[model samples]
Target: MTATLTGVDVAPPAAPAKRRRPVPGWLAVVPLLVFTAIAFGVPALAMLNGAFTVKDQATGASSYTTGNLTASLQGAYLTALTGSVKLSAVSAALGTLLGLPLAQAVVTSRSRAVREAVLTASGVLANFGGVPLAFAFVATLGNAGVLTVHLHLTDHGWDLYSFWGLVIVYLYFLIPLMVLTIAPALEGLRTQWREAAQNNGATGVQYWRHVALPVLAPSLLGGLVLLFGSAFAAYATAAAMVGSAVPLVTLQIADALSGNVLVGQENVALALSLDMVLVAGLVMAVYLPLQRRSARWLA
Candidate 1:
């Protein structure tokens, strides 16, 4: 027998039909795809073509060849490549080491104003690079500079055009960049975790060693990769300060294109650019995995 309630509505309320977006999901991504194609893809393909092609000055004809890549890997070019790698590694390592503690201080600070002030300064300083940065260092540390003359720094063998001087300049921006990169990860450290560690009779050092470091390892390594890439790809400051005194791949690339040292080596510049792209790609490969790992832990 069927029974009906007098004042009841039991039809599941029509299940609240799903709302459709006015635009397709993929439509929103079209602009980004086009931009990437024009900006990165086109340039990359052009570089590849140029790197493998040789133009004859006599006949005005172009021929495909691998000699550009070969030339890029030998003699002075090889030295520049190695020097860039070394400089990048050193600056990135030092930046990470110094920035970590500073970020920790910001995170653990009791005063909000102090934290804000430091972070604001770091943000400004991190983006301070290129020509202005080089000039500032030169005026303060260069030969016949204010500090160099006033403090007898030149008397003590301080040279702003040297490799180490370039490293010091790189550290100026890199440390702040590291601080900015790693701050959010530092903030993600749960207070409950610290409290739990303390409740278990763990010392501060023990807590950091056994718990915090393991969690923060990914973020730290990721920051190092970022700094390495920054130092590796830097052009302007080094070009301005050290010029050709330091053997950097970027300088070599510039010389190749501008014929500063040799004429008709434009294709060689493309080959060097390709090498830089590969190095940058390697850094990205290492960074992506660490970033994903950090997101899982810190998120």
Candidate 2:
């Protein structure tokens, strides 16, 4: 009855508006660009400049020369480099060998308590470094250490300040790193694959060689590379244990910079840069293949 007087009411449809804010490409990279410039680029350039320049003792005049780089390529620096490389390789290889089994054991264990204990121990050992670990090893394996006292019982001797001793100490750190790295890789493996392999009558060794290895290789290789780098760059443990009696590249560089020789300051900086570049190159060489293989596997 009221329709005679009521006006028809209607609403217009809302328009579909475009997004007002778009992400800025340059803004996304700003933090990285800033970090590179401040943290790496500037310091790298400074070191490069210092490496080639000879400063006058009195006037401090700088003259560019290849003498420092040339000297570094020879003499103690070269020997130290070789030693560092050898030690790193040995430690990494040994660590991987030891860790793979330990990781497998931990991951495949039926006991949750054992797995928890292993993981906890690894986590603790991973962060253990410097004088404390060194002293602990020294007190256990040094000439006057607890183990040395028992060594005479077996006609064996212990010297915790030697190269092999350093390797053993390095293994303590490297094993934990290997476990931390490889255990996750092992755990990440799908149980279905193992079950399927077993269903096909594949032995443990066969499954490992064919199925598990291919899957785990990337992580294993990555862990080795990391261990090598850590061992190569190590100074504190070596210094505390053997001091300059065994001249590691890092320790030598530190000595050059801080020792009584004032002229070696710039050379030390140069040597450090060289060491950095060499280690970086070695890491990249190891990393690229693993990365490619990993991508292929994932793909």
Candidate 3:
């Protein structure tokens, strides 16, 4: 070491920095891309192909036509579609309304255990569908079911097989799903915004109307549409609970797929799928933009 300017000596220069490994970029996404192509893309293409055609089984000839779609939209099929839409809409609306408060509760709760428990339960409940869920509801409320037996509910003319009972069953999962979707949106709301509103002497309702509602509107709408789609595509639970009694679109599709109906039912089933896809795509088109706008505030 050498002294400099009759003072202390400094150390030698430091070694060069090591470069970090470059991220895997698109490779990281390849697995999901492959899975999507297999699961969603394949089925979508198959449905599109099947929807707009008729195949002559004996002659091995295929012809394109819109007749399948036409048949799908007319008569009892159309009624089923309408019923599904109405059910989905009612459930989505109810879920969104009820879930907002639950989400806000979860978000605002001071206890870590409360938040974790709610979220954990929400995740499980959202996915708890199909035969088991339907069977459970039936056992709890169906004719001569547990509650029905204990309370003599049938004397009151309450029918669990009816549309209203189905709606109640749907709410179980729908509300939890809505809670999960809306929770993040609620958390995205800055505390500063609430404080700012309070600083201006705004009441709770006033704050919600002028500030929080506008910010949350997109998220809520997105969640609503998603809920609608969830209810629309649901098959097993509806099938198991009410069976042929409920003329929902999914049940009709299942009937057609099972070859239990007239000729050309296969294409008709696919045509129904196409209709559902169009509705889902339309909702997604609306949802994406809203989600992006919501992200701006959150970001």
TM-score leader: 1
lDDT of 2 at 143: 76
Report lDDT (CA) for all predictions.
0.95, 0.81, 0.91
Q: How do these models rank on lDDT, best leading?
A: 1, 3, 2
| Candidate 3 lDDT tens digits, 149-215 | 9999899988888787888889999999999999999999998998999999998999999999999
**Model 2, range 114-139, lDDT digits (tens) per residue?**
99999999999987888898999888
**Distance from true location, Cα of 151 in model 3, Å:** 2.7
Q: Candidate 2: list runs displaced more than 4 Å.
A: 1-19, 23-29, 153-155, 260-265, 295-299
Collision count for each candidate, in order: 0, 0, 0
**What does candidate 3 score on TM?**
0.87
296: Cα error in model 1, Å: 0.7
Error of 1 at 178 (Å): 0.4
Regions of candidate 1 where Cα sits further than 4 Å from its true position: 1-22
